[model samples]
Target: MSNSTHISTLIKERTGLDVGTQFRADLETILHDLAKGDLEQYLADLRATNENAPPWQTLMRALTISETYFFRDSAPFQLLRQPILPNIILERRHHKRLELNVWSAGCSTGEEAYSLAILLYELLPDLDSWTIRLKASDINNHAVQIARQGIYREWAFRHTNNGFQTRYFDPAPGGWQIKPHIQRMVSFSQNNLLNEVPRPQFDLVFCRNVLLYIANDFTKAIETLIFDSLIPGGWLIMGQSEAIRWQRERWTTHVFADATLYQKPLPHQIMTPPSRYPIASIPAMPDYELALDALYNERSSEAEQILKGILAEKPGHAPTHILLAYILGSRHALSSAHRHLDDALNSDGMLADAHYLRATLFLEEGKDVESREALRAALYCQRDHPLAALMLGNLYASIGDMAKASRTWESARQAVIGLPPETRVSVLSDMTAAGFDALVKGQLGIANK
Candidate 1:
């Protein structure tokens, strides 16, 4: 039998999981690497050395998504603040007692859950008065433990400002540790969104940036579960790229200034079927490259106009809102910038740039506390966001935490190393040789000592 056939048969026999026909390319690569005598030898050695090998969990950790950061997207939280959240609060207040329940399904390492907590505390002062509940669950047990600890590296605070960092986190051995109060707001558990029963009703369900990996049937099932998990008239928030593909009549689409959000049917509200004909062919929005170039060329106003135009056509375009938020913030229109930031978050729960921009805006507005929180969110979305790291380091330095600041700057430098050579050179040049040298020497001295 051919290697392809043999490998397929072996995988099917040894692991019930199907490596589909579409994954032939991936299989070929895996076989090529194995043929180099590394993987096969390692497996043979393992089988010979140990009577029982490590569980599939150990193997899966290597394969599953580890590309998560704090606050991964700023736009969804903006939506949460401006409309989805406030509306839920207003509607829920009429109940016997005001209560808000939020679930971060597939909440990798608690960053998303913690981001929600920070937002709630920063935005809503009367949080203690309200019966607020937030839960974060993931299939990965290791991630659950990390999330519960609420400790993260300086890279995790890239987009954060100095003031917020001073207020919320304390220096730990290797990184910053979240305050107990913030950690207390979220309960982390190990539960699979795909196979397990979802915890009871929630006012808002954040299942962002995860569905793209699941099969279509599984996605529909998950969505159905989410729909069932919400209280009447609650909200279902998804990633920017994700649409309500399965259920047309069950939820009403709420097009906000930021991103598209879905509202559940009210108890007495009738489910209206979507028109078979196109209501209107909303032209697909232009790509972010145009906006980025406009911003790069210092034409902030023109970039803002292009972004707004795109948003006008497709309100759910997360990238446009994210770029617009950055442009508006750069122009110092704090309110307008924040509005666009919120729209970006609402539209795409995974756009990291929105969080970074919002952090900058919060800092500019002298809202240090809010800025730090926003920075944390940005870092959580993209751990390698250099600007976020530089700003965070500067914030720490301002607070007289030179050690933390140095560590953060060093991390930023390392992140830049992984970028294109030209980009890396530009970033290093911007840091100036003296600043970069001092940071490197400081780290080296510490290591040696």
Candidate 2:
């Protein structure tokens, strides 16, 4: 096997992480950087020790994503605030028990864990009479240490805008410190999900955005671990981009207005097909969809032809104009793209997509200031425009305004977190909510580094 293959196999065997083709180059680069001048010796040494060794820890840190914020995604938290926790509380209250056990699996740096504690604190009026075991754990020991500190900079509070910082945290040296009362609600520890040890009976388990990094072969095992760890009729929440598709029948799926949740069924409970979002009655422009599909499939010429035909029939069609502008931009025809975008804006002055497309064109022409202004216009039209926020954050980062950049990227993330992963965003192209989120995550990761 090649060195890359050997390293991939080693990583999988040790960490249950698949360094797939998308990240194989990154793995090789890490290997070269760590190996220095002697690759053979480094590989042999890595194979000689257990995964918990310093070398393995360094590798895991490089591979795993530790970028997270409090209330990272609003949708899941809303679901928890609603039927999930309330239902659990009702069940417990019937038995005269006011205890809650919530686990934050792969809880990097404790933001999510603390968010859970805060939620429980807010929801429970008779908090003094309740036993809340909000356990949080991660495979990275370094992250666990940071979590134990309970101090965070401004970047960690990007998602918290409802005066949570003032209510639950106090100003401390280096950053804000989570209040002692909230800190005492959670216990942080280092844990690997692949471990087969006995797990706690958690009322709710949040393993969001963690399984995306795991090998395909190992995701089922980890899912099973989570399933076994939850009590019957308990809830499991995943990230917007993640889901329990395989072996989904084992858990009862609940489709909420904002997010989808899974529950472990009680004994003899009937299993029903997962409910889907109701399709809107309004029909979309079929030709516009055809053009979008053609563009997405890389048949640009065909898409352009279809878009032109649509414009010939309906000159005021802003969506077709936007799609044509996208095609022109992709082909490096900036002037043509701008003309089409102008037409789009003329048809509908409040079109956020047109403004965002204008920003992209400005950025490609090296007009950073113009691009920034265009992005601001887009955001003004629609405050939660993900792509506009993403581009604006990039511009901020490029100019050394990292604090502003983090806030902007967090806004981008928040905008898309409530939507279904497959929900289409950007009329300019075929970007999905999941795709936009990945871009935001990449930006945040670079900022964190």
Candidate 3:
């Protein structure tokens, strides 16, 4: 085999890393740095079957970037503080089992794992009786060692409250030392994700910012392993930039205002956890026409107020929830829109229009996984949803599934034609029939009528 191929094989064999398709240039840089001037000698040494390979950890460390700080990105931590931890508390409360197990796969220097422990401490009450296993691991032993020390410089506290430093850490010589209670919550280890078996039934797993470093194939492998490791209804969080968009079958893209979390769906569960405030009495639900008329006439303020009144009264009314979500979505009130959508689905999981509207919201936000679930849910509820079919076709095209897109658009075309001439569909905005006509012609290669 060529030296480069052999080196790649060695990387995978020794480090469980695939280096990925964009590695050649990076490999050259690494080789140049390793050689300093003697490329030939370096290649020879790398290829040698001496069974005495130089400590691969140095190369692993050189290739991987480990820059991290407490609550880096902060969104997932915010999510933990809200619905995620609280719901877990509720689920286990009745059983008198307050058990929370968490893992940070690419712990780096333990910022993320500690941050999770802090969130648990801050958000939940009576945690003193809970069983908590917060484990953190990095491939780099040096990083693990530093993390075990539980000391941090000021830079790590940039995004964190100084109160956390005061409350959870004690001032020490080199830097502030993590308080014993906080430090005791976490166990630090050096782990190769591919080689190590993840502890199962974890309440949540933070595998963020780690998958992108591995090869595309290995990333998939790691994702599957994570999927298997999570208990039903457990949460998996990735880096904000990562794509859970394509992982619909394995995870529910639980889109929040600040973060998108992947949830291992509970078996036989339909929607997310039920709304805390379910309506007690059935109020007279209003027709969507008033809101639609106001919205279509550019009277969004009038429409929003009407929706607010209706929802405030009959929060249990699924159709009203869907319409409000639709109106709020058009106005780009995404956080509120998602809230209404979640409630609508919870009230009635088979609401096709609500699902379609949700799909469009995710699409506008550039979230594929989030969009995919809603689209699929829309189709699942009512397969002939023309707009959803069209958007699903668009989504298929986006992921380079042209053949599927072609077939899907063909179906979407028929669905569109089957609609009454006056039947209107709204995406980011209301799309005219003529617009849908041209959409298929341009996207599906249909000849002009």
The numbered model that scores best in TM-score is: 2
63-111 in candidate 2: lDDT tens per residue? 7789899999887885565335655775577687778999999999999
User: How does each model score on TM-score?
Assistant: 0.52, 0.60, 0.56
Please report, in order, the local distance difference test score of every candidate based on alpha carbons.
0.63, 0.79, 0.71
> Against the true structure, whose lDDT is highest?
2
Full candidate order by lDDT, most accurate first:
2, 3, 1
What are the per-model numbers of colliding residue pairs? 17, 0, 1
Report how far off residue 416 is in candidate 2 (Å): 32
lDDT of 2 at 377: 85
| Candidate 2 clashing pairs, residues 3+ apart or interchain | none
After superposing candidate 2 on the true structure, give the runs of residues whose Cα lies further than 4 Å from its correct spot.
Answer: 196-200, 274-449
lDDT (C-alpha) at residue 449 in model 1: 53
Error of 2 at 68 (Å): 0.6
Candidates ranked by TM-score: 2, 3, 1
Candidate 2 positional error at 352, Å: 29
Determine which window of 10 residues in candidate 3 has minimal summed lDDT: 275-284
Q: What is the C-alpha RMSD of each candidate to the true structure, in Å?
A: 21.5, 20.5, 14.6
- Which digits, one per residue and each the tens of the lDDT, describe model 3 over residues 91-157? 5765667788898988998888888887776544345777898989888877888899989999989
